[model samples]
Target chain A: MAVDTRKCVGCSDCVVACQTENSVPIGFCRDWVVEVTDGTYPTLELELRSERCNHCDNSPCVRCCPTGASHYDKGGIVVVTHNKCIGCGACIASCPYDARYAHPDGYVDKCTFCLHRVEKGLLPSCVATCPTKCMYFGDLNDPKSPVSIMLKNRKYKTLIPEAGTKPQLYFLI
Target chain B: MREELIVSGRMNPFIDPHLNIWHWQIPLYLFLGGLAAGILFFAALFYLRGKENEYRAAVKIAPMIVPIILIIGLFALFLDLKHKAYFWHLYTVIRLQSPMSWGAWTLMIITPLSFIWAALHIKEVFPKWDWKYQWLKDIETFFQKYKKVIAWLMAIYSVILGVYTGILFSAFNARPLWNTSILGPLFLVSGLSTGTATAILFSKNHEERKTFARIDLLLIAIELFLIVHMFMGFLASTQVQIDAANLFLGGPYTAPFWMLVVAMGLIFPAVLEALELIKFRIPVYIPAILVLFGGIMLRFILAYAGQMSRWLY
Candidate 1:
């Protein structure tokens, strides 16, 4: 997933869309916007970035799961097997991005990257409903993919690379 | 603290960055697991070294609490599980990378071995109590016949269980406070120290009491050093690690950590145990009780502080 931070307006429409699409609880969210403010008052610079599960290559949540409940699918999307989850919260504690939570129904829940839609060759709900068209979802390995084309010229960065999580989410600044 | 001088790539507002998924039961399980591990290790050690008679309270009574305490710890773990019915899922596969997996396998092996260790000693301690039951007598005979092998196995399992408790926390890399390598040895020494104090509390012989006090004093001193090294490790790492170090130095976690774990738990007990080590005949139970309380509080602080730590970036 690649995001064009230049087009984001901190509107949080995608957040609401995700909640409705995934049936996320009232106080919970699968995705959200992080607004960063910089510079002095007279010359303040505001930046809004959409954030969610990175589906990290070195996902700690999957590594820490005792029952193999938190796992990666064929598309490399990290997901939880609700039935096998003992709800020990080990995966929740191990997630560096704070992307997981103990759902009220006795399972660790996280953003699935809209796996149901992706499996059907459809974009994620947040990517599809985004009014600014800032979000881009495609195989990074495919040279012709929009995400690959965007990364070729745009200056991009991932959050906390020093964590060694190797997050897949990229922000084009 | 000046807001007007904010720079680029500066502070950002992140909503709901913390997850309060774990509760008191997790910490309680860790404490009991460590304590049980300590008791079993020391008991097996005393028996192997031919000091069983000299340290009867430790060798005989310590293993006796192994099965009982671990059962309660497993019960606490069961209660903490959201899908308690699916507890068997933990045994379905083995993920070498997962500390929880290692712990589950370790507990499964140790729990039964611990019971066998206790049963071996039961005949020696209470010869007449189980003689009425034929099956109990036969089981005791079987364990007694293989007592030496059981002692060696218990000794090994006990150490694994003790270190596993600390590894379980340290394995969570997201929690910077628990990510250090020293936590393993720190917890092992604490378990040993607390186990020695418990043995001292139960010892009727002055020599046994004095022996345990001396050992506990040494363990406390080592625990102090390991804690200092833990903070130093944190300070020498990344910004996230430095923030985690501050949790103990001057952050909101400092009060409980210092008051319960350091002062009441290590310092006071160390001083009292030190006095007793020098043949000053102080009240052993007071310091013993304090050590146990402090040990439990240490787990509480570790669990809570670990949750507080995050990738602030």
Candidate 2:
């Protein structure tokens, strides 16, 4: 739920861990990183951030899905029901984060926050394998949760807040 | 742990790549859908006014397009699907928020209604031929009895079909180029314009030909206005919206948007039609063909520009 961009080394261990853990197809990813630079050459400021399915509060993919293929599961995490997807690509274009993909298996695929592991009381693959311990995941509703405490103590920002998708991911600057 | 700004403008080690999902199938579907809707709407309008007997060629050709082009369009859409076999899932449930749902249901209804619309005029299709089957005659008689209702339904659904093409793209909120509400009317007017052009090209009667030419000119003018409004609406919204406007203003899509969709599709046709309306008598087919070409180009350009206008990396 919360990430410290200041701590991300851009090693991409999390991306590799995710691909292996979720069996993401080659040349595709469930999570990735973005490196942006601002200002002039002599005084350039660089920012390294991991990006993936925002799992937004108001997910456009779910709303635009005609067959209920994409929907919100328990814990308010967005997911896809593979059998129901007609591979119309409507959800692919509808996602504000550009997170969803038309998997070769005839359905849309994206980050589920590792729901299979989460249900068994395990951290997401990205969080679990993050060597720098920069990735944090916990229910924001629980006051004592690590993500909640991090949010309380740190200044954070979300990507593309203007679009109004209300992304669950946070970057601790 | 600690990190530093190691280098200026360093590319992200992770690549969140762009996927080219919707191909020619989508644009072709949109074009054929608009064309079919336009033909039915115009023909049904003429029939309702009791002038169906006048524009013989337009009337005869129009109803035929509804079934033929619609099947082809639906086929193109089906081919684009990765789960082509699971397409039935779209029909089993209704999601009110989905434009695709509205489109699928409307197409189902329109296909049969269009077939009946053509069947009601069986005598026109074969003027001297006698029916070999009594059941066929009974079906035609039944359609004739409800011809007025059928005409109205066809007209109404044609507009829905035309506008639905625009709503389909406009529903993609993540794509700044397509998220505006104006796209619906812009596409509808474009459909009507193309339909009128097709009518002009095929109308056997001079009066019908002139009427369509005049109407098409007016539609072209409105279409130009809407195109301008579409960009202005985007430019007025947000930074992302402004960027969307810039995509046409001077971005990669500028050449096609201006050259194909604008100059060729709208302005050139408008000039030709205006000349025809003033009795200059330029060949009707030239402008008619231009309009049709422009209509298809518009759909293609919109599809590409919309998908390119993503909100994230």
Candidate 3:
């Protein structure tokens, strides 16, 4: 999905939206903004990128897990089976994108792109609530979807694209 | 919007935050397994020397250590588990591509074999059958024939346990400091050095002690050489790798890495082992304590060094 951070005014409505919609437990978020500022006071350029589970084509978290508790679910979502997890934290450590966390309960937790919501004909909580519309969700393979269309038209970058997770998310330049 | 939040949920911030599995825990299995191996190998040398007291002591204690180290490792692992009670599910790792899966499988195999092997060594510990029961003698003979075979297998398994931790560290390609190919050999050597020191320090006989002393001296010298080689490997690499190496040599984590590994681990053990060879005088338990301390330090340094990411790239 294409994320035009320029449109984002830094309001975290999207963050909270993701929360209530998916019932994400307190003290964690499935998607958020990363802000970077450069140059002196007068010349400062501030930029932000909203990020989530890249759901990469080739994921490291999948490889490092010993218990097979971490894997790709339907629609290419990187889902962690909390019940099956031994909480070894192998996946959390291996993820270069810093996408996963070993929750206090010891199971790996992260954004599943609101798979439950998607199954219910609703946009991801984050995408639906974005005040600035900075987050987008859609099948990367469908060339005609709004996300696929925007991805083709805009110059954007994915986090650590060189790592070859072939992330589905994008930061619109 | 006036954001009243003291801290954003978006950020994962904890002081010395446990980075999931990368928390401060130094995969204690390496140290414990090495300790077991150290004890068992020393026991073997005692057997070779025919020092019955040392052999009996070494054999008895060494076998006991196999389970202790395994249990210690299990405890460390469970402590790290998010679902501590569901820890038994670790045995269901059917995947071959995952090291955690392989480690779980190895642990299952190693624990049982260790119990059987240790059980075989303790003849008196086994339940005494009536003298008239003729079949029990065959069972005794069977354990004797396979004890050496089991010992060899145990040693190999021990090596796998030791080396596998290093391999686990290196698998984190994003963490370049841990990505060195030298890590596997480095860990294996560290295990041998630590284990041998443990064996020598704990032996019950003078000659039994001396044999492991020579081994201790040899291993310490080798480890010293290996330390140099590891540094050289880092120095020969990219700017990113060099900065990562500095985290160990004379950089931020240098104090723990050097003081613990070089001073407490390598130098002290070497000096103590040398006294046995030259002055022919050595303290009984002091050497063992120092050596085990050193081994622990070595692993502590290795682990600490690995976690310090240069991010120079």
Complex DockQ per candidate: 0.49, 0.49, 0.43
Task: Give the per-residue lDDT digits (tens) of candidate 1, residues A114-152.
Answer: 999998999999999999999999888898988899999
Reference-based lDDT, residue B5, model 3: 25
> Compared with the true structure, what per-residue lDDT tens digits does model 2 show for residues A63-172?
89989989999888999999999999898888877777777788888899999999999999999998899989989899999999999999999988888788899999
The residue pairs that clash in candidate 3, if any, are A56-A165, A57-A165, A106-B82, B38-B195
Q: Model 2 segments beyond 4 Å from truth?
A: A40-42, B1-19, B128-132
Comparing 2 with 3 on TM-score, the higher-scoring candidate is 2
Q: What order do candidates take by TM-score, descending?
A: 1, 2, 3
Off by over 4 Å in 1: B1-17
Per-residue lDDT of model 3, residues B1-313, tens digit only: 1121212245553212324244445457667766665555545455545564655556555565677777887677767677676677777766777777787777777777667666565554345624355675576677678766766666667667667766777776555577677777767777777666555554566776677677777877877887788789889986657887888767888888778778877887688778767866668567667767777777766666665563311
Candidate 1 to truth, TM: 0.95
Query: Over the stretch B1-313, how does candidate 1's per-residue lDDT look in tens digits?
Result: 1222211111111224355777798889988988888788888899899999999989997678878889999999999988788889999999899999989999999999988877777767776756677898788887788888988998998898889889999988888889987888888888888788778877899989888888888888899899988988889999999999998889989899989999999999889888877778788899999999989999998888888889843
Residue pairs in candidate 2 whose N, alpha carbon or C atoms collide under 3 angstroms:
none
Each model's lDDT: 0.85, 0.85, 0.69
Docking quality tier of model 1: acceptable
Local error of candidate 2 at B172, Å? 1.1
Each model's backbone clash number:
0, 0, 4
Q: Give the range where candidate 3 chain A is weakest over 10 consecutive residues by summed lDDT.
A: A159-168
